[model samples]
Target: MRKHVRKLKDELVKRGLDAFLAIQNTRYLAGTTAAKAVIVPTDGPPVLICSRLEFDQAKREGWIRDVRAFSRWRAPLRPGERVSFCEPLQLIADCLRELGTRAVGYDRGGKKFVRKLRAAHAASYRELPELMLELRKIKSKEEVTLLQRAAKIAMNGMRCAAESVTVGRTELEVAAEAEREMRIAGSEGTPFPTIVASGRNSWLPHASATRKHLRRGELVVIDFGATWGGYASDMTRTFALSPTKKQLTLIGLVKRAQKAAIGRVRNGAKASNVDKAARIIISRVGYAKFSPHGTGHGVGMEVHEPPGLAPDSKDILRERMVITVEPGIYVPRVGGARWEDMVLVTKKGCKSLTA
Candidate 1:
């Protein structure tokens, strides 16, 4: 993440901003969700500000060295004794003012906070959401390593869930078993709720687990991901309670769609073209209407990010960008099937992490 911070600083300099201020809750700063803040200057080490509640832990786990305890609110005014409450982000404003920061960039901040910054220090601010997103779109080597581990855990969960599918087991039970395996296997948590949909339920693309029991000759779709070290891996697999011609055909078609799309994922590939690759197969199978969503999305700290793989997307794939190649066809009574895999873009081609 040192390189990420350094690149951000470069962008700040190019924008004529003195620094970049990122709050913890935004989840764009260092892939952290802790209740803290980070201020990165163009020419110096970044500073981390932690509230009293998060101070000790931040000091232990934070990357920045200049960690400071966030200042507390002043004692309540003594019956109108001519004292004023602390301004919004007073500590942050004071730090910037002392550093002579006349301009700053941020991913997101409230109006009140921006107003206080301008009023207290005469500092101007510009939005850095695009810059942040661009930085996050390409996965660092370390981030990809973490995501590779996450993908392994998710693959194991899928195996467990597939084995648990039987005539008597409810969808909820299968999902629970998969979730348990992920947790037991060292996953910090799940990116999203485990999904185990069977029979008619499979027709609903994002269906959650229900008490409905599985039965023979039905389709079952399990979609889930594991979170490790704040990175996520997403995948989906379809199973059959009992083999049938139609269900098997549906699964084959989805596989073909995924293969066609994943083959197009490489550095310099147009994201929309990848979507078209998948859509061509589904449309050829006469199930295009059943596919409602995009083919895939960039994945990392968040389950979904930029560089969308869809018909309307203008994003282009870049080397080291990890994404999900998910293709599905959902039909009502005929049942539905979807297969997804986590892949990493490469200069020559892409590697399937779930393979």
Candidate 2:
């Protein structure tokens, strides 16, 4: 947590900002809203302004030192009248004004608030959504540990889903079994809604589980993730109720493609090149047009983060980065095959945590 704060301060300095801020109501790091605010100045300890309802929890969990009741903030106590936030800017601007800040960088998606802040306070504000993603791209040691544990738990769920998939079983039933296994193994929740795409539905990359029952000679694509300690792990594997030569062939192609992609992961490697390694093989087999999505994405506090592995991406892999390698093939009316695994980028290459 201290490291994260220090990094934020460094970014503030790099961006020529006196301070930075983010607002969120819930304890989720991904949360961003007005009900709760975090103020981090380049020169001092951070402060968190939260509702009285969650003040105690924030004080305990938030790494900030100063915890103030958001509701108690008044627009410069008036002598004969009441003041409100309508006239004053957001708490971030308020903090900067109090610190005599001249420059500030804030999270994105607050055009109205940003305009009001510039009008009300003499400070420069820059939107920093991409900045935030860049800061979170490299995983810390603690984060990697949690991701490894989450991968272990998620693999158990994948196995459960694989075992539960048989002829006559509903897609929902298979998904339920996988989720139950992950929960039993100590997962707080699934990062995404569990997917149990069966038969024709397999062609849909992100299809939701339906009531359709599995049948012999059809494919079942189980894509899911388990969350532990706010870290997430994503994995996917296609199954066959009854094996066929063509089905096996497609699965092998996807597996080999993923292997080639994972082999390309390591420090100082371009993510686009890694994606190309897999795309070349898939495209050579006449299934390039069928695979419409990126090869994979960085996994961390969020299921999909920065450092995307795609043909058009400029992200470069670095040590301690956790990413997914998923290669797939989809054929209309003939079902599809997708093989996915989580890996930790290392100096030499990567370790498959979800293998």
Question: What is the lDDT of every predicted structure here?
Answer: 0.84, 0.81
Q: Where does candidate 1 stray beyond 4 Å?
A: 24-35, 71-88
Per-residue lDDT over 112-225 for candidate 1, one digit per residue giving the tens place of the 0 to 100 score: 878877887787888676778888898888889999999999999998998899999999999999999999999988898888889999999989999999999899999999
Q: Please give each candidate's TM-score.
A: 0.92, 0.91
Residue-level lDDT of model 2, residues 1-355, one tens digit each, is: 5677677789889888888766521233322222266777899877666655565566566655566554444445424222223322455566678877887777754787777778778777777777667877888898899999999998999888888999999999999999999999999899999889988999898798999999998989899999988789999999987867888888999999999999899999999999999999999989999888888999988899988999999999999889999988898888888999999999989999997
Instruction: Give the C-alpha miss distance for residue 292 in model 1, angstroms.
Output: 0.7
Model 2, residue 283: C-alpha shift (Å)? 1.8
Residue 296 C-alpha lDDT in model 2: 92
> Candidate 2, which ten residues in sequence have the lowest lDDT sum?
25-34
**Deviation (Å) of 315 in candidate 2:** 1.1
Residue pair clashes in candidate 1: none
